[model samples]
Target: EEPWTLFTDGSSCVDGSGAGLILINPDGVEFTYALRLQFAASNNEAEYEALIVGLRIATQMGVKNIQANVDSKLVANQVLGTYVSKEDNMIKYVEIANGLVSGFKTFSISQVPRSKNKKADALSKIASTSFAHLSKQVLVEVLETKSITGKEVTAARKIRLKARQYEVMEGVLYKRSFLTPWLRCVGPLQAEYVMKEIHEGSCSMHAGPRSLSGRAGESQVPDRRNGLLHEMDRSKSGGNDYRRTSEEICMGQYCMPLWYSKRNNLGQRTMVKSSHGDTPFSLTYGTEAVIPAEIGMPTYRTTAVDVVNNDKELRLNLDLLEERRELAAINEARSKSKMTKYYNSRVRGVAFQPGNFVHRSNDANHAAAGGKLGPKWEGPYEVTDALGNGACKLRSMDETILSRTWNVANLKRCYL
Candidate 1:
């Protein structure tokens, strides 16, 4: 016996959430299901919802052996026990799915990429959603049967009916009115509302009164205590510690952060940076910051602080400051070059030719939308021009050439 195949995909968007599923039996007939979820759900939740519904349908149809396919790697892995479900919702979803799988004698589920599962993916998308930014997006839905299929009915009733006055003109239902040539028939409640609005001349008839209770909440300032930020993450940098310490230091319960920040900043400036192997204070002021303890203890530098000698030393340091900074810049550049060379060595290079279609990394495009969802790569842009250098020009799907050229590193070729 051939195992029935089921494909499911879930869509969550700004407008609405929906789930679409298609089931194929041994007889090779496809039964497609499109569902509009009444309740609010995330994409993952909708995926599980669709799967559960599909499994329930297959069970009702008395299908024993079945193989389910879903595009969600999370759902597929969790069901297969390859991934552990940490979230409460996902854990519950896995449990529910496992229970359903136990009902069938031979049941298996596997994950497929979105491209391979086009039919379910098409059905899963709602009215307005796009993988990339686009002016016009198309969503395809195929159905085997027409929704309305019947011939027009002949008048059979002998009694005077309300339908006699109604007629369809340009697909608009109109009633034969005595006062007017054709009056559009409407529900009694809507007709009453429209007549009232017209008669009353709208004076607060349309927009209702604004209650003070609603505005009273807005008038009061929100409780800052309730919205207090929690320090959840700890940074590895010492600068964060300096900032926190500056905030904590107080004089008689009054925090003198500004005074504390001066010391912290001086300490930070004197601290040796790994990049240039030198202190920022020395690089800026042409001399290291002398500690108060060093002055009190009479160090060699403090003892040598003659007015004439100090002036000459300061002038000499200032003259050599430019040379010191030039060395620092060279060191920083060398370090960066070493890192870049190492990175490039490990990376396998990808080259594009003319007429080649590629996807630019969607990092910048989707950085604001930093969620796990959405495509990581943005286009199927065509390569128009390529220079000997790593720079290239691209053309969009509309055949419009982009003004800005991109580095070859950012361009990834489309496999298909």
Candidate 2:
């Protein structure tokens, strides 16, 4: 039987601390867990907690001969006896982990690269950002205590803010400055307005965040569609003035003859080597359209009046119309084949199988201040369904399926 595999990762951000575990059974079925820590912990502490919890889960499932993968080299080395846990907290965590490890008949811990452990990493980030609820196939748990003191209860303390120079007025803070009477502290909404004005306002210099004083730069680039529209408006200014004049009537009449002459020239060119060597007018009525020159100066065929034989020839041409149309269809297909071959030769072909991870272009989903340094791709979405001809449906790391399928040209494989 194949050995069970466990992948674990941890995340500690300002939002919260979280642990993620993915257990794959011998049958290849998976069970995912997103654990949120209610208590305070460092990133290393979170990683250790994730490993301990995952071991406990595997023990409960009666798993034997298991192999565990973790992205944290510190945790993996400590657990494997390669590194010593010197800190008090780490020592306690290591003991708890070893105690859990003793439950399995055979077990091994190995450190893997972050790229290979992305699913677990994503889950840990999600747990840190949001409260993930447990479902039938998935489990989410809250740990109130650190692994070192599993049963210890911690007391909460309330701290008072010391802002002597700032006063709260109607839920808004105002700072007292020597130069000014009082300066209103800007909230996120006000800050956003200020940034927008600085970046894109008519009077303001169109500068990036890196150029702005004390402002952090965004990862997305600015769109150039507005600049294109402004250029188009400038080009149409002279034409706009001419549109409101009596000269427009004269121009319209002058353009009609030119248009008609162009159309007649195109029709004559098309008839020169048509599928059946016959002009469209001749094919329709079994007689060519008479030109003005032919009417002014009579031609031999135009003057001829052989009505009896003409009727018989007209019947024969009418009967051959279907054959001529079929031949035209064949020629059109051959032309399209050549075009398709040429197009394929110039463009590289990319095919993605279902379950592959890929990053999509971020052109349609840029943030307001996402200057030139902004991320060019948005996701490492999984290919859930491959709709042939270079189209595929994608699902995000969070399990949210995108509404539209993306073309392969707009997608690139993600290594991590």
Best by lDDT: 2
C-alpha-based local distance difference test score of model 1: 0.66
**Predicted candidate 2: what Cα RMSD to the true structure?**
35.2
For candidate 2, report its TM-score.
0.34
Model 2, span 182-211: residue lDDT tens:
344443344344334444543344543334
What's the distance in Å from true for residue 182, model 2? 49
lDDT of each: 0.66, 0.67
Q: Native-vs-model 2 lDDT?
A: 0.67
Candidate 1: worst-modelled 10 consecutive residues by lDDT: 252-261
Which pairs, if any, clash in model 1?
A: none
Tens digit per residue, CA lDDT, model 1, 226-326: 21111212433343232333243321111111111123223445556677787788899897666432332233345547777888988899999999999
Query: For this target, which candidate reaches the highest TM-score against the unseen true structure?
Result: 2
Residue 98, candidate 2: how far off, in angstroms?
0.7
